[model samples]
Target chain A: MITHSNVWRFFTKPLMKTRLAPRRGLNGLAGKDIGDRQSRIIFTVLGFTALTALLLIVLFLFLEGTALFIHPAEDGSRVGLGDFILGSFWYPGYTPPEFGILPLMAASLSVTVLSACLSIPLGMGTALYLSSVAGPRVREWGKPVIELLAAMPSVVLGLVGMMVIAPFMQEWWDVPSGLNMLNASVMLALMAIPTIASIADDALESVPRDLLEASYALGATPLQTLMRTRLPCALSGVGAGIILGLTRAMGETMVVLMCAGGAAQLSFSPLDAVRPMTSTIAAEMGETAVGSSHYSALFAIGITLFLMTFAFNLLASFIAGRYSQKGYQAA
Target chain B: MVNDPNAVEVKTLNFFYGEKQALKNINLDIKRNEITALIGPSGCGKSTFLRLLNRMNDLIAGVRLEGKILLNGMDIYAPEAESADIRRRVGMVFQKPNPFPKSIFNNVAYGPMLHGIKNKHGLNRIVESSLRAAALWEEVKDDLHKSALSLSGGQQQRLCLARALAMEPEVLLMDEPTSALDPISTSKIEELVMDLKNSYTVIIVTHNMQQAARISDKTCFFYMGELIESGATDQIFTLPQQRQTENYITGRFG
Candidate 1:
């Protein structure tokens, strides 16, 4: 008893109803059309493809990284996780290779801290300038240039650090080598400044005009309004920007590899050459034999770097959520 | 002219924004300790005239002014007159309630702090008294530390009123301060404004004819940037002399 006209009515009846109510009809068709359904299915598949790829990559990383603690090395000795992480010495090519990652972890932390010290103040200052101090014409030209800095390749920055900054430092301070922790930190700070400035500028600019007007109407000077009202309101967003910048500085590979001088020493001095975790993995992974203890150790270092960045990301989101909710409501 | 001790005297006042004039030549005297209501249709320059009283129009770019606005016999438009001092002495409450993102205490203390009253005890005293003056002290006394944004709309508007009062202004300029509120809140604000005239000169711009008639002692009707009529509120509402004022008041034309 099912006919072609019945099928036609099923589709055209809703279409006719929608056509009668211009806006609702269009929306209904958008939600129910065959072409739209097909596109949605395609997009879902594409999304799942990315998710599956990420999961597979993470699974591979864990399997290869944990193998170092389970598999016997060429010398028929299994390295324990505690010794691998806590060992102060790391000589992968020695007769009895020592793989203590504590020195690398220290170097990474130091450089990230140093870079943050340099970048945070500079980035926040830039953000404040771009958001409030600059006029419309100045902001129109200036914002894109700041964002363009974020797009600059890290390798180009590494080359500049190695070629320009290293020689300048060597001649100025009479250091043994220009490539040191200070040089690496300086380069990383340059890389982080753009990200911090752009995001923080957006935050400061988004502070309500009503607040500004209220402040002005209150007899407060412009500087007073900015310092007391605007800055406090945008604190969480600015904090998130700084944390993200620090994470980027900590995980940077090319800048540290080229500018850090690659010396694995647990020294507190800024001028001392250092080998951070990221550079070690990037520099050693190519030469280390696949499935060897050295290869697994490199993967283990990757896991550590992943976890560090993950923790920082969590902290950034926490700052953004908690303070933003408590700070302002557009009543 | 004999100097009035506590009155704002406007003489041939004209205002322009870029190429367009927003207010035509006008002359009026706003008395001290009296509620003056400015009633007009939208874009009739009532708000512009109110803002000019406190020099709030100066914040907009490319705006020009002519003639003299005298506050207590001193020309407020003189170059030596600082806008900041004027604003503090002539505080404003905008149409929409705009509380700072800070706590209720901080919100009320903001103006005093800007003027450098950093003492904890002094700030607490000012906050409490200002809230009481705004009729909001009892409701918010328990939650002084809570964020100002958490307050209800009516409470927030009262908080804004308290904030303006904290500066201890001589004149209060309100631009439709209760237009965005519900009826209850509007009545509360109306009562508060009526109470405020005993301590401060109040100039308010309102589109609501009933509100203007109820609380104001003096009423000015503006049409097309021109002051159509000015008189005691009762006479203006009951027996408007000008045809335009009478027509508009009787719901004939805007």
Candidate 2:
């Protein structure tokens, strides 16, 4: 056997080499039976480009937003963003860039708070009616109408706010017969209704039917069941819905621009004219020159809006996740 | 302990879901303080019949009933009768265990809470005693604040039993209470059901032939939404008169 290793090796070499002929047919493919390398490269390039598009958008916003704080013209000094944030008078570039943000905050928060108060109860009630009390046919008809309100354009919302809510507030509440926080808040509530109703309704519907039946079996009235069981169980989703609505109200531009009374005055009176951060950004951005403190300030406003909405959306997602987890346990 | 002519009285009971008939001409007399088992095949209306004890059928849509179901000798289906009040006296445990997403303490105390018992000590007492009766207190007494969902399937089923018991209802309706459970859980539920008959009237619906044999005193065999035969559990299992019921019971056919 030892001797055959060396003697037969020479004879077997030709048979092993010539048994299968080498072929070079698949020139562009990775292997004779496999796909080409260009396909994978093309796919990877496409995927990276798609991801970078989103990344570039966020990066661009952040980059432009940095100028909102960096005022290179004023002695090449960095502008203190806090002054714009805290200052109550927000008349940007009117001789010195009046950067009082408190008035704008008051305007924004007043509208947002008032709108939330108006919508939460109404929307939660509507949600309860649709999810727990209403018949299937009624629910089917009611849900789409509520969602349609959400699908409406913000400009259309602004137009309606100007036409409807402003006059109504003036006539009924005896508001100062002008654009005010109350008018804008009313419009915001209208805009928020769909978001609140749809999510709250989903939350309520997500509650286990057997739990409702169990409550009913335990002699709980429909009202009692809704108040005690369904409401608590659906509180998470309801909270998420409320937060989503709040973010919408806070970041709402056109409605507040038109109806919130664009006055940079710090006051709690819903009847008085108000200027919100979003309105300030929208009104000042077009006329201001690039690299001007006012221009960067607008981007700064955009950043503030972005951060605020991002925080609210994160909170909403957290709450919604918890609510759905509760539902999962019940399910 | 309702001192009346009969605990439950049904006369000319006919129930239908759309065009499909569920219960046909069911006239039943459910005696007080006894376990009555309603045995049938799948979709044979045993659970449907159980739901009528307290008008639980009111939850279902398009469920038509042409009959009267009475409890404690009162005409329960009368125009003035309150289904909610009737349900309060008739606690139900479903086929699948469904506990609230609350603590075990709260789960046991929920029924009493609904009836306006707000005293903390009272609720605690009720919760403790109900869980004790259901044989779940020892396993859960250390962590009553924990969510009921953390318990195993058997424990959750027991917790549901405790929940029902907390109400101190006169009549208890169980719809396949142990079908979703393992053999051990099934035995535990059977024991609880047997123990409960000392004070409460128990009505159960089961597809398991052996369960009907073991737990029920009076057994009602239903077929195709009609009551085929009803007798003592001994007679029904040992010597059923109706051929279909005999065929159903003696492993011949469902």
Candidate 3:
């Protein structure tokens, strides 16, 4: 060592050069040989089973539903759903069988509108209060309890609406007897609240704590920080909640059947009797005889309902996606 | 935020997080318009001490304070003190750059707007000037509306400085303002700190010994949350009075 060190002082030292290639592992599996032809057989069978089931459903819906498009077999086929969807009446089987859908459509639209108005604000407020204002101890356990309400069976919910909500709404408003659109919409809204609350609360909880801390350090009060920093940041999530709650309200069936009187007329009022699609489908699905014009007409209503919901679902999917993308586009 | 608009005096100050004491009993004085650097090893309480200056540690749960932390000889840990005002006057730049997920203009405007500076044009002017003072305006003037998070780490740290500066605090506290940054960013912040001392008293907590030697007029060496040495920078580096300080300075021990 000493000899080498002394020798290095005689002239400038040469630079040492080193090169090493990285070790490669068998991480790329592209060249690997396949095994077990039976695995492919199992996978194919499973895949085709699911595909067959889905295709069968689509085929059933198309053939049975599109049956209305073509004339019914023999005797009296009646006008296609052209008259059924657009006509402003719906008395399926009376001396004069009125089957215009405008009145029923109007009634359903009003009930849904009323329910959305009632549910969204209440759900949003509760969610905000729960997620932001409530302390950790409460929110830690309260979230699951709130969400459990959404999972209650529709039949059970309908029973509760009849036994508890209907009488309460009647007593609270001091307006009258019998089931009506007002009762049904209000009850449906109660059913939708949990969906709104859970989604909106999650949205609020997602707001960054650093943002809140920055606002606080700048001397913004709690309320001001919540409004400017947290709430606006969570707006898209809250919007999602409302959309979910609206879906629940729109698609709800048994509760509407139990509470909303199956009378089709556009009354421009929450108190008046009404008939929504779900209730119509439920109330008369059994009473109408097999293969009767009324039975076929009910099927026509089913087709109309399926299409309407399909469009609503599509719109909801689009709007929610749009908001989510725009909401996080800040960076 | 301005340290009661007077110099701060500390006597036997100590701090804790829950049961674990983070800062041992220590006495220090930070004078006006001077840059004071706190140099120490990791977990030696430099950053903890810096947070104590603005009462930023109050936000963490179960933090306890003992002895006196006085600004203008008024006890800041008193029952009546407003933490909001203290933090506003004693603006902090954290270790990692934490520019808000907002536009550059919005980040700078945040503090003034919080304090109710409502005139739109005036707020805009303050944002521009603060960004300029932080040396970020020239780089970002073309796109003030761009998200603050879009900036590189150096630019983001400078944006944080701009945010703190917008509040017009008299004392600026930085906790490892460049440790998370590259060498160029570290040097830029060092230069900025030097320029900043002309108008504001600055307290910096850093692990970089060279930074303490370069920019600080006064340097405090902390070991295990205790102030082992405090003096003029050159004197402390050249001739630390304590054995621990000398050992630490000579790389014998942290």
Provide the TM-score for each candidate, comma-separated: 0.92, 0.89, 0.84
Candidate 1 local lDDT, residue A86: 88
Clashing pairs in 3: A89-A100, B1-B89, B1-B90, B2-B89
Residues A1-331 of candidate 1 have per-residue lDDT tens digits of 7799987775566546645654545565565755456556768999999999999999999999989888887898778889888888888887567778998999999999999998998999899999878888899989999999988899999999999999999999999999999999999999999999998998898898888878888887778889988988888889899999999999899999999999888889999999999999989999999998899999998988889999999999998888889864321
lDDT, candidate 3, B24-69, per-residue tens? 9999888888889999788898888888888878778789989887
N/CA/C clash count, model 1:
2
* Candidate 1: stretches off by over 4 Å: A1-33, A328-331, B1-5
Give the TM-score comparing model 2 with the true structure, all chains together: 0.89
Model 2 has a clash total of: 4
| Best DockQ among the predictions, by candidate number | 1
* Candidate 2 structure quality by residue, lDDT tens digits, A92-177: 64655566577877778888999999999888888988987899999989999999889988888788878877778788877666
- All models: lDDT? 0.90, 0.84, 0.79
Q: List, residue by residue over A1-331, the lDDT tens digit for candidate 3.
A: 6687666642222112111323234642232212223345557899999999988866665665455446543345454566777877776665446667777778777878898888988898889889778887888888888888888887887787678767787788776744778788888888889999988889888987877767776666678778877877777777777877877787788888888877788677776778887788778878977665666666766677767777776776676676555433352
User: In model 2, what lDDT does residue B63 have?
Assistant: 86
Question: Can you give the lDDT of residue A10 in candidate 3?
Answer: 29
